[model samples]
Target: MPGRGAGRVLCVSEFVRNVRLWFAPQEIREEGGTPDYRFSLANERTFLAWLRTALALIGGGFAVDQFLPDLRWAWRAGLALALLAAGVLCALRAVNHWVRTERAMRRGEDLPVSRFPALLSLVVAVVAVAMVVVVLTGWEG
Candidate 1:
């Protein structure tokens, strides 16, 4: 029997256990770590959601970046940049939200509801509406 493999397996198992334990603080607060874990997972999900939205925006930008036949390449490129910028901004916000939520959880304080993300969402909504208007009226010129 090749028992050397067992030693490697044990080492791997120990490493994973150590890392998982280290993932969260071990101070053993009254609230435990579940809430923190929840907030962390929520943050991760939010990031994924933002990534999906970014993909949609980039795809739309490419699809409609140059609707008119005579539109300049610079115009299309600028739209692409705007879409990418929106994605980057969204990512930054998701990280910021996670950090604040995690900090609150650590301090055993009431988690604060954030308005910044809601405001950003509204901004995106308005931009979407404006984009529709521009696309619809693009042929007028």
Candidate 2:
């Protein structure tokens, strides 16, 4: 029944909602039911953990670029980019997960299933493997 313009408007509105949920805790509290302090604190701690991980990833990228021996320029750059990208992704997902968990708590609903941990594990493993290959191959430039 809606026109294309209406569909576009809906999409834009949904995006705005998601952005607010990710960044605006005060707004979320105003719109949604209030959750327990303990639960909210726990969710905040989890978000902090994710932030730490993101920082570590970014730091590790710099470390690898600075300290790793005998890496070609392109390889170094690629590795750094990969780590930094993973870090950015982790950070973006962190806010999403926090919002989702907070909303679940407010709604008195079961917590949402989380795939972030598994995804983090996979990223770490891939980085490790890549490093191992580089070290074994003695890639130098």
Candidate 3:
């Protein structure tokens, strides 16, 4: 009987620990007093918004790759890859920003500053300009 329930207990404990680590890591959870739940929810909403943007970018990349069969191979690949890369970066930025913002809020500090928004906008603008050139130049496959 000693080991009969040991595996179940271990699995349950591990699952609980993982959930705790993900939602309330000791470092962030233990720091400072708890902020208002409304603020935490607002931060989470912003995180979801960033993730939605990332998903849109990723979907746009796939649509370009799939729908623009007439586009030249180089142009198609370049645009799609740029979008996909931007999506990847956006997703990572989303997570990083969420964690930083949450930690700062927990510690009663000013939110962390980031230039990723400007950088991402520049990337999208450059891609749009390139697309315009491709359209004007008749770069069809």
TM-score top scorer: 2
Q: Enumerate clash totals for all models, in the order shown.
A: 0, 0, 0
Query: How many clashes in candidate 2?
Result: 0
> What's the CA error at residue 122 for candidate 3, in Å?
0.8
lDDT of 2 by residue, 28-122 (tens): 77655788798899999999999999999999999889987578777788998999999999998788778778787877889988777998899
Ranking by TM-score: 2, 3, 1
The lDDT values for all models are 0.61, 0.84, 0.83
lDDT of 3 by residue, 1-141 (tens): 869699889957854554454566776687788889999999999999999999999998998889877788888898999999999989877876787787788888999888889999898899889877877674533
In model 3, where is the ten-residue run with the lowest total lDDT? 14-23
Candidate No. with top lDDT: 2
Candidate achieving higher TM-score, 1 or 3: 3
Name the runs in model 1 displaced over 4 angstroms. 1-39, 66-75
By the lDDT metric, which is better: model 2 or model 3?
2
